[model samples]
Target chain A: MEHAVETTLTVNGIEVTRRIEPRRNLVDFLREELGLTGSHVGCEHGVCGACTVRVDGEIVRGCLMLAVQANGCKVETIEGLSDSGELARLQKAFHDRNALQCGFCTPAMLMAARDLQLKNPKASREEIRTHLSGNYCRCTGYQAIVDAIEDVLHG
Target chain B: MKAPSFAYAKPRSLEEAFDLLERPGAKILAGGQSLVPSLNMRLSSPELLVDITGISSLAGIQVGRTFRIGALVTHAQIERSAEIRKQVPLLAEAAAHIAHPAIRNRGTLGGSLALADPAAEYPACALALNATLVLLGRKGERRVPAGSFFKGLFETDLRTGELLAAVEFPRVERSAFLELARRQGDYAIIGLAGVADGSGRRIAFLGAGATPVLAKGASAASSLEQALKALGNDIDPPADLYHSSATKLHLAKVLLSRAWNTLSKPH
Candidate 1:
């Protein structure tokens, strides 16, 4: 039996194909095979949200989805989203607001907050908090993270 | 942690999926939110995974007198679905409390029920609505009430080769889902979903027992204290690390009182 599964998908606007083990998670695929290591893997069980990325425009846990499942799917990670200038406004706002500390959770936090921005432009503080509750930020305590997204929303 | 090696299969039709499931150590991979995590931790080591996403029949939402939610419907879909928000807001409200948005985007309704984690919100909501679960097997279709569906921890009435087709929920005159967790996205330590319609009122509790506790007519116990006191008989909760049996009971009563008090008020 062929242990490796062949998958073709668009990653950050680039179409790529690879043979990977059926169990290789999307995050590991991005990191090991593609060398796009922006997404962090924390609490691989899905609690920490450090591995959040966009699959077909919706944020999902990269560690929770296998690479073989990415066939024909469009994925947007921190590298691609950043390269595309999609996060310029949120990034600058995060920078100005000092929304990050230690920088471990920044990529995932920005990805998650940006998802809320695209979906709900005029979200309230509570809504932003609820949306961001998935991305764990131990350093900034989320005050700055929420403020960063709110800045992009209002500014 | 890396997942143990496993072969993968994509079944284009339910028939093909059923045949693949007949394999001794094969599992159905729906959203892979819970399963992937377990696989990574080596908690489960299935030899094969039959990915069901390609099965077109398993994905959709049909609204009628009762809503039919396809098994593959993601929690994020439920949270944002206009139909669910309009007809059965109970599901939408409960779906929002499940994990975070990233988790919701991939965690599916069928996967959640099939796994049947005691702390999950969907089971409680299903029980509160008196929803019927549709299961498909080689013999054909079978309908099981949500009350009797969950057998124990991570166990359901789903036979070895049966696939959960969809869940049917009746329209309710009023419904609400309330939960208490340490954080916004964490699983509820104690939660309650209460729904009422012409049929009657029912309250279901999560994190109360081996499965979601369906409290039939317990909300109509005259008073909140009376209802909670009566609920003790229905829920002999097993202790988990996060909450002891007494603590779970206490939280259940507090949440039930709060939910029942709201249900007590005329809608």
Candidate 2:
């Protein structure tokens, strides 16, 4: 079957139009089509938070959402967060706390942490643990990650 | 793995959407959290995907006689919905335990109810709350009570070409929810949703059997022990990698007792 849909989406405040395969997911489109690889694809089934990105105002797993579904929606990835100076404090906290080791999960971790910092600013350590539960770190850096997020929550 | 190639369409209106569903080998695509994964694994390869995101009319929260939630309302929306928190607190609590902050952001309420996963949170909560599912298809709109809607494991009363448009949760006086999972975001090994009225209580168990069902005669069990014993008789749990049927039934009783106490107590 051949399926192609022509649609335009505002990615990081830039409007781009493309005719792409219907099967292409948002993560693959961001990386392959737009060359925005900040969002990693860890679990294509949406278990891993590696492919997380803010759509409109909510974080969605990029691997599960098709690019076609993002048509006319605003997408904010880690690159956009950096460019827009949105992650300045969180980034510094991660670096200062050594929250990242291999850095494969850093971008998505930051994305997920940013959300926690805003929504549950007064969350306890356990709450922070639950918030970041979806994002996995092969390096087992839960303590540093939680500390970094806590630092920002209070910092 | 990437999903196999398939024809896709985004319908601007429900009429167009219903029309697309008539196409052979077409599947309705909602939040895509579940369907996309199945597609990527080639576990399901529909010839066409009828995307409903374009139908703006199919989203949002409406509070009237009952809590009418659009099928496209994401789990995150449910967690944050003040109306849901006030009216159906059990649903709000259940939504909080779905997957994670990100998955909850994209997983839809309608899709969860329609997929009818045995371990999912909504089915059990819906059963406990006596919620009604609104479906639309070529035959037009129909309302199926939650009790009869869920057929079996990962199955429902939803027919081919039928679209789960919304779910209506009846207003209840008191309710509480509980579940056991290996991890926070993992599927529950067993769960229960309990509701209380002036005299009696109703409890629904998830992952206790082929489907989320009432503890047989559990309504009459006035105490926790009775509720547990009633559940053992009601449910025939299936064994999986994580648990044996006996273990699941035992855990089901434990959780149901907790739910019973939680509901029986005053706030």
lDDT of 1: 0.89
Off by over 4 Å in 2: none
Model 2 chain A: weakest 10-residue lDDT segment is A1-10
lDDT, candidate 1, A114-144, per-residue tens: 8988899999999999888878777756998
Clashes of 2: 0
Residue A89 local lDDT, model 1: 96
* lDDT of all predictions: 0.89, 0.87
| Maximum-DockQ candidate | 1
Pull out the clashing pairs in model 1: none
What RMSD value applies to candidate 1?
1.5
Q: For candidate 1, give the lDDT of residue B48.
A: 97
TM-score of chain A of each: 0.96, 0.97
